[model samples]
Target: DTAVSQTPKYLVTQMGNDKSIKCEQNLGHDTMYWYKQDSKKFLKIMFSYNNKELIINETVPNRFSPKSPDKAHLNLHINSLELGDSAVYFCASSQDPSGRPPYNEQFFGPGTRLTVL
Candidate 1:
């Protein structure tokens, strides 16, 4: 069984197009998150959801919106995809809001590589 799954592992498209990435987790966890890894490999948290509540990180752009259909799924929709949005999108989950330990240990999916032309 897949612990986590995302569609269109590799997305290539022209700028200004809208795109979406879907994520689901079978783990009985209360929280899920979306992270974006830039070209430099810097991982940044975009949005987090737990128990149907949305917790968005301030640095995330308005163009990105995260939707959680249920406790088990959180999907990301991007409007007017830009060249700068070309990065690896990763979906992760945690057991609780406190995170794993001193730092949150998130179980991540394979990742979605988005390319903008």
Candidate 2:
């Protein structure tokens, strides 16, 4: 089984539409993250949730929101999607970095490619 997985591997939508991507991890990691990869393939961390609390929130537009109901799931919702929202959204999970050895590795799921027209 995949350690991390995402639904709707591809998403196509129009401008001004709202869409959501679901993600889940079964590795028992305490931290999950949402990342966006631009057309140039530059990946940026959009949100990070650890132990049911949000610990890192980048300067993303208000239109994008990350919700975590528990430690194993982190969902991304985009409201009034814009053309710039077209990108590959990735879900990743990692063990708490505060541990002894400071685990810095993240396991990524098969990304969801979002296209906006």
Candidate 3:
């Protein structure tokens, strides 16, 4: 059983198009994050959610939005996508850092590759 899963593993679309990637975690984690890996393979955190509340928002553009309807799910919606948006997006989950462990290793999902032309 996959601990974390993302839909539309491969997405190809034209510029200005809107797309969404859905993510879910069954590990019963309270924290989830969205990371983007560019063609250069530089992974950067885009957003983070803890217990259904937005905890971290990086320097991502307003065109990109992340929604967490519940602690188990985190979704990314991109509007007016551009060529620069082409990259691999990853969804990860981990126990809340405030807990006993102080730090928990994140469980990553199979990345979703988005290509904008």
Candidate 4:
């Protein structure tokens, strides 16, 4: 079974559109995150949710928002998508900080490729 999964593995859209990507994790992890990989292949954290609480990454733009219905799911929503938004988005999960006696590595899903024209 996949530990983490994301829908719509590829998306192509025009500028100024809105889109959302859904993600689910079956690892029973408490912390879930959304990350963006730009054209340069640099991965940046966009949002993190631990037990359904939001933990925004200050570097992320206001245009991007993340919602988690439960500890097992976190979805990313982007509004007024710009060409700069063209990138791959990854969903990940890790054990809650308190549960990490050792170290917990983040497990990433197959990314969703978003292209804005």
Q: Which candidate number would show the highest lDDT if scored against the true structure?
A: 3
Local accuracy of candidate 4 as per-residue lDDT tens digits, 47-112: 889999986565887899888999999999999999999999999998874546554688999999
Candidate scoring better on lDDT of 2 and 4: 2
Question: Per-residue lDDT for 1-117 in model 2, tens only?
Answer: 999999889999999999999999999999999999999999999999999799999999999989999899999999999999999999999998453566778999999999999
RMSD value for candidate 2:
1.3
Global local distance difference test of model 1: 0.88
> Is 1 or 3 the stronger prediction by lDDT?
3
Error of 3 at 8 (Å): 0.8
Where does candidate 4 stray beyond 4 Å? 98-101
Ranking by lDDT: 3, 2, 4, 1
Candidate 1: regions farther than 4 A off: 100-103
Instruction: Give the alpha carbon lDDT tens digit for every residue of 1-117 in model 3.
Output: 989999989999999999999999999999999999998999999999999999889999999999999999999999999999999999999998453565578899999999999
Provide the lowest-lDDT 10-residue window in model 1.
96-105
Query: If candidate 4 were superposed on the true structure by all CA atoms, what would the RMSD be?
Result: 1.6
Q: Rank the candidates by TM-score, best first.
A: 2, 3, 4, 1
lDDT of 1 by residue, 1-22 (tens): 8888888799999999999999
Clashing pairs in model 4, backbone N/Cα/C closer than 3 A: none
* TM-scores, all models, native as reference: 0.93, 0.95, 0.95, 0.93
lDDT of 4 at 80: 97
